[model samples]
Target: MTSSLFEPEPGKDKEASSASMPPALKLSLEMGPLVIFFVANFFGQWLIDHVPLFSSFEKPIFPATALFMIAIISSLATSWILARRVLVMPLVSGVFVLIFGSLTLWLQDATFVKIKPTITSVLFALILFGGLLFKKSLLGYVFDSAFQLDAEGWRKLTFRWAFFFLFLALVNEIIWRNFSDDFWTNFHVLASTIFTFIFLATQMPMIMRHSLEQPPSDKNEDHAD
Candidate 1:
């Protein structure tokens, strides 16, 4: 009935304590919603059809919405426990999930749920790009605590990610609007994961190239300074 979650793993274990935390931990935490969504969808029918607390969630729509809410809360709790604060992007996504998921269930239309990822992606792109427009590296706020990238490297990485998320948004909109639920679901999980992993892999060269060539403590910043 309960599960003990392992503490959030650090992204760069090599310099584990040097960095605030790991990007991988943030990535894994972000997956919390998707994992909950998929699991809830998969077993929804069985529960609503048999169980009582979920009896009110007899409909697929309600169960899906309920799961979104539960996932958001759980994600916030996890982040609070690990980082002692709620992350911005996850909080943003959670708000959208609660809002749109509620609309989908209330309207008995799945379109709202289907568009959740698209909306999330687009919003992320906007936020990232907007920061760049003002010559601000907002990614620093999210990733600074994780891996330390040089200023130029952080700028380039943020811009690339902004565009990448926009592209993903377009792809999600196209697929969900045109394809069957089974097709969308399968591609959402499998294809998306593969694409993301490959994208992260492709960034290795940039990461290595921009890494703090030496420890960033006093003597190092002073030498560079």
Candidate 2:
């Protein structure tokens, strides 16, 4: 989506109105699908028993996966409709959901679905690190709409996120390999979300430290002259 959503109008004081994701809207777009997936998985049997709508599926995970896939696609579409473009992160995740989710259903193997997060995380990590190799801070594109940071800040933030994504990938691999399906599912929805938010919170001091000083706009400079 265009960073304009976060940018202030020309005449406004930039410091008074920094670009940012509206918390409620951000949560809805980011967490809404995951919440749906979790609820479907946790209460699959109950849903099948209580609601005739879900009775057609013999297995619980199948229906849950189907609903999860649908929710994710819908969420992405909604974001696009609202923002007039797709955010890179969600767009990438949505593509993986379509690919692996289809495989999971077609092959009737939860393995595909289970590995989706790992694959997504690893891919993102690689992309971030790869950009750094070429002297690009691609993560800035992802967050620029919501934050104003100097070049150094973007570089540091990108490096930290690259490592973070790698860490998440490793954790997902370990969990899904050793844990039960239910446990892994819960981890994906609950634990991962919590950990991600905590990590983001921990980075606040760095973000503030690296925030770019608001420069005088051309109009303001002209007025001053």
Candidate 2 residue runs with Cα over 4 Å from true position: 1-23, 50-58, 213-225
Stretches of model 1 off by over 4 angstroms after superposition: 1-25, 53-62, 214-225
Q: For residues 140-166, what per-residue lDDT tens digits would candidate 1 score against the true structure?
A: 655665556777667777898898889
**C-alpha lDDT of residue 197 in model 1:** 80
Residue 1's lDDT in candidate 2: 20
RMSD to truth, every model: 7.3, 7.3
Lowest-sum lDDT 10-residue window in model 2: 216-225
Tens-place lDDT digits, model 2, residues 1-225: 234432233223344333233536655887888888888988888877887866766556666888888988887777656654455677788889889989987877889999999999999999999988998888875666467777767878899999999999999999999998889889999999988989989887767667665443522332211
> What lDDT is obtained when candidate 2 is compared to the true structure?
0.76
Top lDDT model:
2
Residue pairs with clashing backbones, model 2 = none
How many collisions between residues are there in candidate 1?
1
Worst 10 residues of 1 by lDDT: 1-10
